[model samples]
Every structure is written in C-alpha cells, then in structure tokens.
Target: MLALKAENISKQYRLGEVGTGTLSHDLNRFWHKVRGKEDPYFKIGEANDRSSKGNSDYVWSLRDINFEIEQGDAVGIIGKNGAGKSTLLKLLSKVTKPTTGKIFTNGRIASLLEVGTGFHPEMTGRENVFLNGAILGMTRKEIKRKFDEIVDFSGVERYIDTPVKRYSSGMYVRLAFAVAAHLESEILIVDEVLAVGDAEFQKKCLGKMGDVTKGEGRTILFVSHNLPSILQLCKKGILLEHGLLKESADISTIISMYTHNAESEDIIPNSNKDVYLKSFKSYTEDDLESNLQTAKNGVLEFNIYSNKNLKNVKIGIGFNDDMGNRLFTPFSGHFQKMFDLSIGENTIYCTLDNFPLKSGKYTCEIYIGDNTETLDYYDKGLIVNVKDNFTLEKPDYSQGYFIINQKWTNERK
Candidate 1:
C-alpha cells in the first residue's frame, strides 16, 4: 500500500535582501487575499539571484518532485546541501504548505526535523512529552500509558520534572528523541538531528530507528548528510538535485553517484571569510599541475607551492572509502620531522611507492600547523581513485572502508 505520495509538488520562496521590503510583500499578499485573487508570484517565473544583478521574483526550492513510498519501506533521501532534501521533508511534514501539487498520506507523520523541535523550553520535560503527544493526536490516557517508558528510554527520568530550559543539551536531545520514537505514529521522518550527540547516543538512536523499522510496520523517511548511516539503515534511496528528483535506486549505487558527481560551487557560506579559502598549487611527477588519481599499489609523487614559511608543516595523506571514513592516515610525523622553510617561495616533493590500499576512492588532507595548533588546513589536497587488476580473495564483509589481505584458516564446522 502506498503510505505517502507526493505528486508534482513544488515550493517557492521570495528572496528579500532588505528588511523593509517585507512590509511591502505582506501588503501585496493581504491585498491579493481581499480581492479573492491568487498571489501573482505563485508562478516561478523568476531568475536566480546569482545570475541576475537585481531581480525580484520567486525561486523554486522544489520543482515537480514526484514519488511514492510503500508502507514499511525505509527510504533515504540523499543529495548535496541545497538539493531540496529538507524542503521536501518540510512539505511532507506539513510544516510549510506547497505552492503547487498535492500530498496524500495514509497515516499520521512524526518528524524530527531538528533537535529540540516541537519542544517548549519553558515547559518541563514531562509536560512537553504530553504536549507533543497531544499535538500528534494522542489522548491523555494514551500519553500517560507511555509516560514512564519514554522517560526510561530517554535516560532523563531524573530531570523529567525540570523545565527543558534547564536540561543539558544532551538531555534535551534524549528527551526529544524519546518522545518522537515512542509516539507510535504510522510514519516517522527524521533529519540529521543525530549529528550533535556523542557517539554512544548516536548508536542508540540508530539502533532504535532500526528496531522501529524491524519490529513495527511503520514507514520512515530519513534525511541525512552522513551517507554511511543512510546506506546502513535504508534499503531504498532517493536522490535530489536542484530541487528535482534525479533518481531512485539501491543505496549503494545512489551513494556512488552522489560522491562522483559532487561539486563545490553549491556551497553557501555562513560568512565571507568562510568563502575565501587560502589557495595553494600542487603538482605530481615533476609537473606543475593538479588533479591526481593513482591506481592501487602505484607510486604517488607530490609537490606543493607555498609562499610563507610554514611552521610544524607536515605532509600527510589518508585513504577513505566512498562514505568518507578514514581507512588509513600516513603522515610525516611518523618520521619525527618538521619543515622550516624560507619565506617567499618554496617547493617540496614526496613519493609513495606501492601504496598499501585496495581499489577504491580516497582523499588526502594536507596541513600546515604551528606547535600550538593547525594554522591552515586543506581538506581536498588530493582525490585519488585506486584500481587493482589482479584477482584477490574477498572477505565475507567486503563493504568496510578498506580491504586488508588477512590470512584465514577454517576448521571443519
């Protein structure tokens, strides 16, 4: 059965650079409301701010995104930031109304868009639980029945009576997630709210989510920036790009496509300083150039150009799988050496012959640090793809970050 269906859904928003402009837009909307006329800006006949010098029109956050999910399917929504993942979820959760199209759902939806969402800081944890439950259409008797279980599961029983404003950040998350999980809704939609807590809490949340899918017949829509968690928890995947549904497929194939086609121009900066990263040129094999992707067990030679004399300068490289887990980290620190270069121009080269890694995608992070801390960091120093031609024994669990050649002998079972 189709638990949720979004048909030709689209959302549009107007960009306002100045604060005073909002009053004019509000008045226009009010006048349109009184006249029984539709908002003229409903149609997305607007240019993006990036392409135009000064254009005032609507920008589409989602454009005709159409999909349906069956009951009991755990679907992962994957995309680069600003790919309209959150916008779709918001529309589904009914936090914001869609500008066009319709959404059909079989049952109530419980969404955890952000930590402490739907939580009242002034209210006690216990009170908020009941408040949220009531908002989800639960009866007082129903909430009372699950009250202790929720408190115990959250591990916040000690502060259940305290106002949420006084609760620690972790405590607030625990209580909030507990309410969402135990609400017994037909569908659950969770965003990247798990990134804030400690690893143990994250594991607990993942385990609870897994159980929610396994033990209950509920449908789940999960959105996250962490690809590994998505792949591990979701069997089906949906990819979004530029507010459009790009593809829906198996998790593995979807992740591979996302990483390979990932681009940096989509990044929005929190500050101007964040947008201007320090620039440095790199080369390979005595050539002054960039872009390196070497084969497995092949030699990798590097040369870096820098103007300032860097302190505690260490040349390092690491190997990561498609999900961005560091499988290996090799650094010049192992050699107990540091670079003290002369000011102005300097160049250095290092060679790694027969690198110890199986065929996969890996990234090298270069750093220059002082004795106190890192002065500069370059995350994408090198992006390498390793290829191996020889046939090798594969492990039973070959999906980890690396492939190590380990000997195995099994007795008769």
Candidate 2:
C-alpha cells in the first residue's frame, strides 16, 4: 500500500518577494491566463543552484518531482543545503502549497519541520502539548492518556507549565518532538530540526523514531544531514539536487552516491550577502584513484568573494574526523595575521607538509569571521577522501589520525 505519493510536484519562488510576483509580472501572468496561455513565469524559472548567479528572476525550488513511500516505510531525504529538501517537507506538511502538481498522502501527518513549529509562544508548554495534539486530530482524552509518556520522554516536566517562550531552544525542540512522536499520527514528517537538540536527546529521538516505524508500523519521511542516523532509521532514501529528484534507492546506495559524487560539496554558493566561501579545492596530492593520499604534502585553497572590502578578518580551518569533531583547527588571528578581503576577491591557502588524516573519509570545516561578526561559516566545507600513503602501501592509523615518523639506529661503540 502506498502511504504517500507525489506526482510532478514543483515549487517556484520569485527571487526577492514572497508571493507570486511583482505587479507587472502579476499582470503579465493575468494577461497570459486571459488568452488561455500557459503561465509566462513558469518558463522563466531556472534550476535552484545557489552557487551561481542566474539571469532568471524565478527559481524552481523543486521541479517535476515524483516519488512514492510505501506504508510503514521510513524514508530518508538526502540533499545538500538549499537543495529543496525543506521545501518538499513543507509542501508535504501542508505548511505551504506547491506552485504546481499534486500530493496524495494517507493518514494524519505530524510534522516537526522546525524548532517549536506550530507552537504558540504565549502558551505554556503543557498547553502547547494539548494544542499540538489537537492539531493532529487527537481528542483531549487521547492526549491525556499519552501525556505522561510524552512528558517523561521529553524530560521537561519541571517546565511544562512555563510559557514556551521562556523555554530554551533545546527545551522547545524536545517538547515539540515528544508531542509529535507520542501522538497517534500515522505519518511523521521530520526535518533537520533535531539538530538543535544535544547529542543525548538526538540519540533518544532517533531510537524512538526507529520504534515508531519498526514496531508500530508508522510511516516516516525524515530529512537530515546526519547520514549515520539516516542509515540507522531509514530503509530507503530519496536524493534531490537543485530541486529535482536525482535518485531514489536503498539507504546505502544513496549514501554512497551522496559521498562519492564528482561535483564537490565543498563549494559554498556565492551570496548576495556580505561574504561567503566561493570555492574550495584540495590540491594535486592525490593517489592513483584521484583521492587525497594519506601522509602527503598538499594545499587546501579557499577562494572567497566579498561584496565589499572587510577588515579584521580572520579565517579558521578545522580538520575534522568523520564524526564531525575537529582534530585541530588553525586560526589566522591567532598568528596576528588578520587578513583583509578586497571588494571582489580574496584567496587563502593552507598548506600541509604531510596531510594529517589517516586513510579515511573526513570533512573539512571553514569559518571566516572578524572581531564583531561572522562573514561565513561552512561546517562541511569539504568532504575529503584519504586513501593509502604516497609511499607506504598501508598508512599507520593505529592510535590516531596524525602519524608521527620515528627511526632508531645503534649508536657509536
């Protein structure tokens, strides 16, 4: 049985404004419709590529998307940031309507699209729980039966009577997630909102979601950047790129494609904002497979674009393990080398005598900021693959990522 189906769904948005278009464009759309012509702006939309400046005023956040979720299936939606993952979730959650196409879904959907979604700030946590339950079509009595369990799971019992506005972001997400999960909704739609919670809470929530699908046979549509958690909870995956359905397959296959794609996830799109990382490149210290070889000399280059000249700028680069923990991060300001960014372009290169990471896949983190404000920060600045050593067949990765070279010889008689 199909739990949900989306057919040719596409979402379009004007570059600057929220609603359909400006008055002139609206009049154009109206004029075309009067003549029984297709919408003019519909043909004007370009793909949702954030990295480049486009000529079109309209962009398709999602285009011609078609997919189906089987009943009781937990499906993970994987994509880069700004790749229409959240837009698709919002459409399915009915937070917004698609510009075109249809979505057919079975049963009630409880969505945690963002922190404190559907929550009224004036309402207390306890009141908000009931409010969310009501929104999910649960009777007051039904909520009462599950109320204690929800409270316990959230671990926010002491603050249940406090106005949710007074609660911390962490508290708000915990209560919100608990309410969504405990309610008897047949379909659960969760965005990357769980990232707001601490590690322990995230783990707890992941476990509950697993049970919701495997034990209770509920359907789930989850969108998250955390691939390991996605693999653990979802049996299948849907990959989207530039607002189009790129691939739909088992979770493992989707993960492999997402990681190994030739197009780099390292590049941050050019922003209309003040400044951002334009491109990141790992140099020619690659092995035979064109992968970054372990324990080899290399340079990481960053080309940053800025709308205007900036001062007191500092660039920080983090070498991270696969688990997203920074092994070490180097900061420019620490060396009293506060760099300057020209109005148009700035280039910074970080060199390594021997690449630090062992043979593994790692992520490089980049942050550019100044004394007062942050210019740009890319947590997954680069997804790096470290293969065998340039010299050794197998690099020594015994105790840690960094290898220390050593040698001993007999002294004089």
Candidate 3:
C-alpha cells in the first residue's frame, strides 16, 4: 500500500508581499468567492522559474506535483536552489499548507526539516525531546522508553539538562535528529539538516535512517544537496525543476538525468576578487569526447585567469560519479608542487596514467586555493564518460569504484 501520496499539489507565493497583497487583489478573491468561482489570482501566477524575470507578482512555487511512495521506501528529492524542494517538504510535513491540491499520508510523521526545528530554545535538551515527542503524538511512557537511546545516539549526553539556546548548531541538529529518529513514527521526513552536522554524525544519521526503513519498514522522504547521501540512502528519486515535477524513477536513472541536465556555465569573474578559473575540460589522450577506456591514460586541462600574480597556489580536481559521490581527489599539494601564476591566463595540464575508473559517467570539480585563502572553486565543471576496453565480463556497479589490473592464481592444496 502507498504510505504517502500527493495529487496536483501547488504552492503559490506573492513576490515582495506578505499574505495576499494589496486590497484590490483581496477584493478580487472575495468577489470570486461570492460568485462561486475559483480564486482569480491563481490564473495569473507563473511557474517558479528563477532564471527569468516574470511580470506577474504571484509565482507557483510548486505546480501540479503528483507522486506516491510505498511503505518501506526511501525516496530522495533533488533539485537546485529555488526549485521548490523545500516547499514540497513543508507541504508534506504540514508545516505549511499548499496553495492548491491535497496530500494524504498513512501514519504519523516526524520531520527534521532544519536545524533546531520543533525545538524550544528556552527548554532543556531533555525537555525538548519529550516535548517534540509529545507533539508527534507519542505518549510520555513511549518517549521515556526511548529517551536514553536518543541521548546516546545524539552524543550530547553531558548537555542533556542544558538549555538548547546554549547549544551549537551541530548540537542542535544532533539532538533534534536523535529525537525524531528514535521516536515512534511511521513516516520520516528529513531535509538538508544533515549538512550542518559533522561527517561522523552525518554517517551515523544515514545509518539510522537506513535502519528506520529497512529494520522498521517505515517510509522516508529525504531532501539533501549532498547527492552521495541521497544515493546511499534512497532507492527512488524525484527530480524537481523550477517547481515542476521533472521525473520520478529509480535512483540511478534519476541521478543520471540530474547530472546530465546540470548547468555547466563557464567559470567567470564575479564580485569575489581572487583567482578566476576561466575554463576546465577533460578528455582522453586522443582528444576524444572525454571518453576513457579502462586502464588508459587521460588528460585534464584547465585555464586560470588571475588578477594578481599568485605564489604557492594549489590546484585540486575531484572525480565524482553521476550521483556526486567523490570517488577520488587529486591535489597538486600532494606532490609538494605549487604554481606561480602570472597576471593573465595560465593553462595547466594533468595526466591520468591508466585511469582506474570503470565504465560510468563522471563529473569534475575544480578547486584553486591556498592554505590561507580560497581563490576560486567550481563544483560542476566538466562531464566525462568511461568505457571498458577489455572483452572480459563487466563487473556490477556494487563491486567497486574501479577496475584495477590484478593477477589472480589458484594454487593446489
């Protein structure tokens, strides 16, 4: 059975105004109501496109979004900023009502939408746990049963009796997630809250989320900018573009679509006055379409246009799978090398001897900085595809990240 469903869900917001707007729009809405007609303002709203400037004052943050999630399923919602990802989650969590359409859910939901969500600053950590639990429809007895477990998992036991206002941002999220994950709830909704926590804590939260769906058979709706976490935890993915449902499919396909459609604008100088990364591209030694065969050499070429001569500059490149998981990072500092970039254009080339990456689609992230200051960085710079060269049987995706050259022998007992 489906645990959650959304039908024709759309949220409209008036730009630069609170509530409806001027008295004229209000009167128009009231007149439509008296005439037994739908809200006239709904017709004037435009899609939530951020790239273009629109004339309408009202914009549909989410337009006609429809999807269903089965019980025990973990779904990831992915999109760029202003794509209405948070709006959809707010509607599902009942934190805000949709401007149009309905959402149906099977059981109680515990949401960790942001840092310190549903937490009382004046209350102690221990008290907030019980308070949030009670708000989620958990009885005091049930909360007490899981109280110690939550405290332990959060790793903030010493501050249990301290007021939440005194806690750091990390501590706030740690405690908040601990309460939501441990309490009894059939549906769990998490936004990018994990981004605030440390790496170890994020891993713990991911593990707990996996357990919540696998061990308890609960449903999860996760929204994260961290694609690796989403890919690791979610079996299904929903892509949103400009407040519209772009696609819903398996996690791998959705990730592929997302990466392929990402904006690849050339790096240009902005208000930030530092080293400028003009362009970056990757290709095989033969200058092919950036496609590499297994155990073959490749080249990563990039140009840096600097405003001032840079000394002791470090350049780094990261290889990531389609899901944005960092497979490996090659840094110039690792080789104890630094660049003396003169004021103008300087091109640097790095070669990958016997590329270890297996057959898959990958993207590049470029970083140019020093130990003291950051010059420039580009998260999505270039895209490349790797293919297998040998006729041997291809390994499954889960086997590993690379196909290494190894010699295998069997000895007689």
Candidate 4:
C-alpha cells in the first residue's frame, strides 16, 4: 500500500530585503483573517522580474509537486539550495501548509529537517526525548520501550540529564536524530539535518535509515546536498528546480541529470584563454570524452591546459571510493616546487600507478586553488574502472577498501 501521496503541492513566500520571511506579511495575513476575507495582495504572489528584484512579492518555493511513496520506498528529494526540497518536506511534515494542493498520508509522519526540531531547549535531553516522541504521536509506554536505545544511538548518554540548550550544535542534532529514528513513525521525512553530524555519525545515521527502510518496511522522504548519499540510500529520486518538478525516477539517472544541469550552465566551454581557471576534458583513447568508463587496471588521462602567467598553481588529484570516502589525495604542492609554464598553453599529466584497487568504480576529483582556499572544484573528474585483481589464493575479502600490502604473522598459544 502507498504510505504517502502529494498532489500539486505548492508553497509561496514573500521575500524581503534581508531576513527569513517578513513579519509585515504575517501581520497583513493576520489582519485579513480578522476581516474574514482573503487578502487583496494574495493575487500578487512573489514577483520574479528583475525590475521588482527588491520589491515585496510572494515567491513560489514549491510549485505543482506531485509524487507517491509506497511502503518501504526511500525517495530522495534532491536539488540545489532554494529548490524547494526542504519546503516540500516541511509541507509533508505539516510544519508548514502548502499554499495550494493536498496530501494524504496513511501513517504518522515524523520529520527532522533541522537540529533540535520539536525540542525544548530548556528541557534536559532525557526529557526532550520523551517530548519529541510524544509530539510524533508516540505513547509514553511506546517511547519507554526504545528510550535506552535512543540514548545510546545519540552518543549522549552522559549528558542525557543535561539541558539541551547546553549541548553543542552537534549534540543537539544527534539527540534530535536519535529521537526521530527511534520513535515509531511509519513515514519518515528527513532533510539535510544529517549534514551537521560528523563523518562517523552521518554514516551511522545512514545505516540506521537503511535499516528503517529495508528491515522495518517504513516509507521515507530524504533531502540532501550529498548526491552520493542519495545515490546510495535511495532507490528513487525526485528532482526539483526553481520551484518546479524537473523529473523523478532511478536515483542514479536523476542525480546525473542534476549534476549535469548544475554544471552545464556555469561551465564555459573548454578554452585556451587567460582566465583564473580553465576546464579540462575527461576522455578515453577511443574519443569517448564524456561519461568515460574503463575496466579494472584502466588508464585515463586529463587533457589539462594552462593559459595564464601562473606560479604556485598547486595541481592535485584525489581519489574517492564508490561510497564517497576519500581513498587517496596526492598533490604537486607536496613537492614544494611550482610548475613553470608559458603563457599560451601547457599540459600536466597524472597516471594511476600499481592500481591495487578491487573491481569497482572510483571518482577522481581535480583541484586548482590558491594556497589558502579552493578557487575551482571539479568533482568526478574521472570515473576509473577497477577490474578484479586475480590473487593466487582465493581472496580473503575481509579487509575493508583499498588493498593493504601489510605483512602479518599468526601464532596460536
């Protein structure tokens, strides 16, 4: 059975010169409510024209969004910031109402869109746990059954009795997530709240979410800036752009479209001109320039070009495993010496040596930045295919990621 459904859900907000929404709009809405009539300005929703750039007008945060989630389906809502992914989740969670359209949900919907959501800062972590669970429609006894596990999962057992206001931003997020995950909610709506946690905690949350969708058979709506997370945890993805639904389908395909569309507009064609940063093409021997794929032990090279009077351009390549873990980071800066190049054009070469990696794909990230900060970033510079390395004895298959050439001796007493 379908757990949740939304049809033509849309939200509009009035923009101000500075701030998150305006109190003036709120007052106008309130005064109109007392008069028992719609506000005359309701027809003039946020304006989009450049002439009215700074004027007070309602802007659509979500427009004509439609989707359905079946039981145990993990749907990822992805788009650039301000694309209404969060607004959609907020409407679904009932934190905010849509300006138009309707939604039907079969079960209790719990959402964790921000840190300390539905939490009382004055209350202790232990108290907030119960409070949050109760707000999610859980009975006291039901929350009691999962209390200990929630505390453990949050890693805040020591401070369970401490006021949440005293906790660090990270601690608040941890406890909030713990309550959201443990409480009995058939439908889950999670925004980028996971991004606040450290790497380990984020991984833990991902595993927990996976368990919820796979083992517990719950429906989930997740929004995230981490594309790889969406690709990993979601079977389906919904793309939203400029308050409109772009597409929804296989997670990988949607993410590819988003990634491509995101970069297509900003990226100038590869040129040999005097600029801050130049674009390099990713290609293979057969001239398959885009989406190049190779078998294990494959060789791929970047056709790098430099077109400025440059010094100290620290060129580097980073390798990330399929799960988005940084496997290796090597840079020319390690050598301390900068490349001396002519003004018009030049090429820098990088080759993957030894290729001990197992059969899987790896993403190469290229960087060209000032010594202090990153000026330009190119993720998925090249996707290299690593074929299986035939070992003499059946591979142990126990070691985690990256072939480690370590010597070990075992002794039994």
TM-score of each prediction: 0.73, 0.72, 0.84, 0.68
Off by over 4 Å in 1: 17-42, 46-54, 263-326, 331-352, 362-384, 388-413
User: What overall lDDT, based on C-alpha atoms, would model 2 receive against the true structure?
Assistant: 0.85
Separate clash counts for every candidate: 0, 0, 0, 6
Ranked candidates, highest TM-score first: 3, 1, 2, 4
Give lDDT tens digits, candidate 1, residues 63-142.
88889899988899987677788889999999988978999999888888887889999999999999999988899999
Residue 404: error of model 1 in Å? 8.7
lDDT of each: 0.69, 0.85, 0.86, 0.72
1-413: candidate 3 lDDT, tens digit per residue = 88999999999999999866889989998999999999988888888888899999999999999999999999999887788999999999999999889999999999999999999999999999999999999999999999999999999999999999999999999999999999999999999888788778989999999999999999999998666678789999999999999999998788778767553333433435567778766668875564567777877777888888879999998888755678999889999888899988899888888888988776667889887887877653255667777776777768888877776779755
lDDT of 2 by residue, 1-413 (tens): 89899999999999889797889988998999999999988888899999899998889999999999998999999998889999999999999999899999999999999999999999999999999999999999999999999999999999999999999999999999999999999999999999889879999999999999999999999998776678778999999998999999998778777877733335646486689988876654443236555567766677889989888888888776644566877678778888888998798876666766677666676788989997887753266666666554554467678764556779855
Root-mean-square deviation of candidate 1 = 6.7
Q: Report the lDDT of model 1 for residue 332.
A: 74
Cα-based lDDT at residue 314, candidate 1: 65
